[model samples]
Target: MDAQAAAPEQNEVPTGAKQQQAQRPAEDLVWIDTPGIGQRGGIIIKDLRLSIKNGEFVYLIGKTGSGKSTLLRLLYGDVPLTAGVGRVAGFDLRRLDEESIPYLRRRLGIVFQDFQLLSDRNVYQNLAFVLRATGWRDETKIKERILEVLRNVGMQGTQDKFTYELSGGEQQRIAVARALLNEPELIIADEPTGNLDPNTSAEILRLLLDINHRQGTAVVMATHDYTMILKFPSRTVKIDGGTLHEVQKKTAEPSDRAKE
Candidate 1:
């Protein structure tokens, strides 16, 4: 896919450019150029370009209201792209109809800060709900898939427990298992560690990294945890002053360690 520079104004919808970009072959899981994203009259993010390839782990860092969530929403079609080109999971953001949104989401797994598990249901029921909704018909297959994903996330024995019965870290592990149920090509984790303690947060991060390594699923995690970034450095993207900037990872020197 060709990359083009974009400079979009608020309230300007570059439909033409979006169409052109969508028609090109998608070499990346997500490719956007100066995408104006948000509600029609008010654009939260303007002229933002980002590209995330398969099997890549990227940290999206920005202060609250810096459009990190909005960008993630754009990828999953929660927010419409008002301008610029965006192709996510082979779906053209410009021409994505409501009917196609679910199909697009099937290729994506979203982990939110709040574990949005059904409070009234046990782990098994919660997972079964998603499988049923996604058109998994065979009872045996659904049961087997649930068991497999639970084992994958190391939460194999917690299936009969309710969400309230699990600790924060355990709940997060269940959430991760839920995301892995469909074997999504990309997992968009929006503050997955936000509600956990530091130790639990570290464990969650390690789980995500393990999933990325073993499953080859691209992970775009939006977080404010600088400590985690310093400890597990990778490609980092920051949103500041309404634009996206790639933060270079610097190797820690002996002096830096001493200061720590």
Candidate 2:
């Protein structure tokens, strides 16, 4: 592995910083404590503690099978919280029942590795389906919201196109548009750029950063692409040894030119 890709030092976040975090509970959009998360007959991670503040952008990096995806699933209510205290976007994961899962999900935006666009539907229809399912009854309002999100992701004119007709970058942009439909407080992305080339991945990452900067939506992303991180530095955590640890990179501050 390249030096930049090597695992970051564990437990490098200062204790005082951690203390400051505890004092600001109201700012955390996602909080977990000693969380027991996994499928039936098994738990992938144990005693995991995490707190993501409002409007912050963080990266989750780890090797394959390191419980990164499980953590993301737990946040979005896909996996049941078998043990421990958990909260996300104001919903308690420990108490989330099937009936309340949709309500919890509406407050979050989830992006998957593969663009999970409905193949039978065009971009407009795909977005409209979510709005309608989420109790968006007014067609005019739904169309306006869809158009706004599309424009935000820079995919405004492609609404009439099918998923197959769009490029991977464009499809991912649409996926992002779908995520933005609810104006979610947090966006949980799982290996969102895994399917794209480096250039395309850069585009998608930039788009996400723009959203984070402009909309003040908290973002937690899991990725294996360290180069992208090197290009766009932010608070990062690594999943290793069945635990999550903050990664303290020694890189210099990114130049404004790099951000542009």
Candidate 3:
């Protein structure tokens, strides 16, 4: 597909790169090695093992019902597996039942396409709600973090506005700002730009890339936009018929800005 590199000259990363990759830790690993759960439902995912490393920008390419969203929920502990195991930010997913789920999610930042913000709360209040709910005690730290993440998302001045008053891009930025409240090690995004225009989508991608670079926050994103994958090439994992394949693009360098 247009999203993948020309099938790789071979099926491996550069030798030294692979060595470094393998040397990394197994913790904070956001991937699903197996699937299927709940009383009424059977397995939705197969033995779907994937390991995304730290500071890497990865694209989850798959079509609808290909289990993209479900995969994300699994990482955030929203979906419990029937078999196999998953480790995200040092927490075990398979063993995490209702009680441990809160702790697992608190370590992660999740952004959704629908911008899950409260309509009744202003941007600042919305962020404050999460900070207080999650047990942030210091009033000063809460205010500081609220401002910090908002500034990170380029929405510091818009904090006083209602969610409905912002553009689609701005609303998404607020959602991202909220996600950053926990200072999470991993940021999971599901179709984050599905509703935005191309220009806005590029801005969001740039923001995500910047956060990934500055904070070394591992990013796992699910998207149907193969064109987006082509523009900013990175390690991509594709799922179809419950299979996993790692894609290594020729890889864009700073010198290849024109190509990008």
lDDT of 2 at 231: 83
| Per-candidate TM-score against the hidden true structure | 0.86, 0.87, 0.84
Q: Note the clash tally of each candidate.
A: 0, 0, 2
Give lDDT tens digits, candidate 2, residues 91-141. Answer: 777667766677667778899999999999999999999877776666777
Cα lDDT over the full model 1 = 0.80
Residue-level lDDT of model 1, residues 1-260, one tens digit each, is: 00001111211224543343344344598899855676657777777888888877889999999989988998899988767778887678877777677777777899999989999999999999987777676777778888888998889988899999999999999999998877788999999999999999988888888788777788899999999878877788998888888995553332332233
Off by over 4 Å in 1: 1-26, 249-260
Question: Relative to the true structure, how large is the alpha-carbon lDDT of every model?
Answer: 0.80, 0.80, 0.74
Residue runs of model 3 more than 4 Å from their true location after superposition: 1-28, 35-39, 249-260
Q: What is the C-alpha RMSD of each candidate to the true structure, in Å?
A: 9.2, 10.9, 10.9
- Model 1: number of clashes? 0
> What's the residue-level lDDT of 177 in candidate 2?
93
Q: Which is the leading candidate under TM-score? A: 2
In model 2, how large is the Cα lDDT of residue 111? 92
